[model samples]
Target: MTDGSIQQTRLPTRTVVLHIGRHKTGSSSIQATLRHNQAQLLQRGVLVPKNLPPNLSGFFSHVFSRAPEALKFNVERGHGRQQAQKHGNRLLERLAHELEAFTGNRIVLSGEEACALHPDEVAQVRDRLGPVLAPAGQQVDFRVLLYTRDPVAYASSAMQQNIKKNVKLLEDHKPVVLRKAPGWYQRTHAAWAGVFGADAVEFRSFETACAAPGGLIGDFLTAAGIPPEGIEPQRANDSIADEIAGFLSSSHVPKLPPDQRGLWSAGFDLSTADQEILFAIRGSKGGLLTASEQAGLWDAVAADMRFIEREFGITYGAAQTAGAVPFGPVFMDDLKAALPRLSPPVRRGLLAYLRDRSAPGDPGQLQPEGI
Candidate 1:
């Protein structure tokens, strides 16, 4: 049946939860779970809007982005400001329509890109979106949820993610991540808290949340006022394997910069077996930032680490030295086993990468296995 034909409905006062992500912090996992469990969530009076994708970054960015032309979404569409403005207007209709049809008493909107919105833009979101989303004669409470991790770790993982998606990030010839971790956190905190009121903002440690009872999804559900019962947890957007990241750090680039970078294509191929091997090595590497870089990251972010502790009541523990550790044995063993199975193209690429690494920080390089 058509949406128009379906009976329109109204519900009680709603809490519109906006989970703004500070990326690399399990946002993908939460979005995936919510997207896949839409029907189940709706049954319990939570609307994960059908009109929109699970990640609302595109939606949010179009509305608040100061530079629409630079947005990956708009750039991909060949959309300049005029087109982006037109697109944002189109989203409003969809937003209103979704809210008009929503029977649930709560809404959960997520987008990692929203983490960077300015305070004024956040208020713009409130002013513009609140009325369209509120059910008739019911109050709409806006709550912002943000999950953060240790500065060093967050940057390390984020850098690896950049390289995985866009090999060309290597062009900068700088540290894969810059020393901006501290400012990144403070800005995100200010953007949300400055408008929403500190009381309306919820901050959780990503590592802690993932380690808790039902893991990240469960923790998020509880934070969003949903019962965790019977909702299966999810995992998504696994970072490139540690060994792979380490390999890239040494072999491909002169330097890896923390600033944003991307690519249109990888210029390489990964067959099913190669893809499987990539999946298998995910947790086995870390400390992608070299020793000097890791220390610099911590030094830069240390003051804010204390600020976050005092202000948000969050604390990050010690981090490992960069470039000192070998990619985990698990990565070594798994790749050793999977090497024979990789497609010739991927196998050749791996062998070439292994042969040309510029540094010797890792002792467990696959040459030991005679690949």
Candidate 2:
């Protein structure tokens, strides 16, 4: 038998709920809900860090002294790694210290990228956070909250997301495969559990949660241990309009300022007609996935799904019917509207410019000779 005192169990004066997003898992909605209800959560003895940017660095800093290279990839790929890292340590440290100093509240830090980190990186986070609470005479408990969608459904949604983002690389894509298997989830969860312990982790199905008694927002709040009363369902990071995506893809490409250039560049590689066809196929609601060449792409995704389930413990749910969301027509309309405004030569020039810019060049050739 053990003593029942707070000190005996190392009960955390602060509770850190890390919502490592598995991407395309309604992470934005969850983050938005938490942000909107920060005050209410605090009133309930829960401290969701407000100062921290909705990114992973702050959470990662709690696990490691320095940012990992993979984190840099996430940053370079426009995941806000650098910006998040910039204030990660300060934000987490401040939250931890403040919660300890002021109220015996639990600090909940939620971000989806936390789920994508490598296992070793997760371990570093656990160690870093563990010591901070120990020395402060407070217990630190790490809890991971995540949602899994049916593999096919997740893939379908994810593909739409990729198309919206103009992402070109099919090789790095993991939608159909993730739906078919659980490897991605298993790896991500394993990373967190390895560091924080399995008991500290919790998993929920987004599909089920969404269809639960009150819907996704309600389910999320309940899962986070918050009462659902008076909680407004705050939707965050919803998809941009298809016209907006088209405009961004065209006008916003070459002219993006230096700081923002990298983001636009990371979209689809349009060098090949097949790539364009794939993009169109994936982007369309009723787009066929079984064209002669496209079959290979689908096969790849299927293989990936198998790998994901085998590795991550993620399971695919029933397939959801795809709907005509009007993104494609809107994108096309936006493209046409933008095209007539530019002269033929100017259009050709723009295409050439983008082609040249996206093409591989030696590091020494970063700046052209005659500027």
Per-model TM values vs. the true structure? 0.85, 0.62
The CA lDDT of each predicted structure is 0.74, 0.54
- Model 2, range 236-320, lDDT digits (tens) per residue? 5444332223323453333334465354344432334323322332223322122332344434356445544564454553333
Tell me the spans in candidate 1 whose CA falls farther than 4 Å from its real position.
1-12, 167-176, 248-276, 355-371
Write one digit per residue (lDDT tens) for candidate 1, span 315-334.
Answer: 98666756544445565677
TM-score of 1: 0.85
For residue 282, model 1's alpha carbon misses the true position, in angstroms, by 4.3
Clash pairs, candidate 1, are: 175-256, 175-257, 176-256, 176-257, 176-258, 177-258, 178-258, 242-285, 291-322
Please give the lDDT score at residue 370 for candidate 2: 12
**Per-candidate count of clashing residue pairs (backbone under 3 Å):** 9, 24
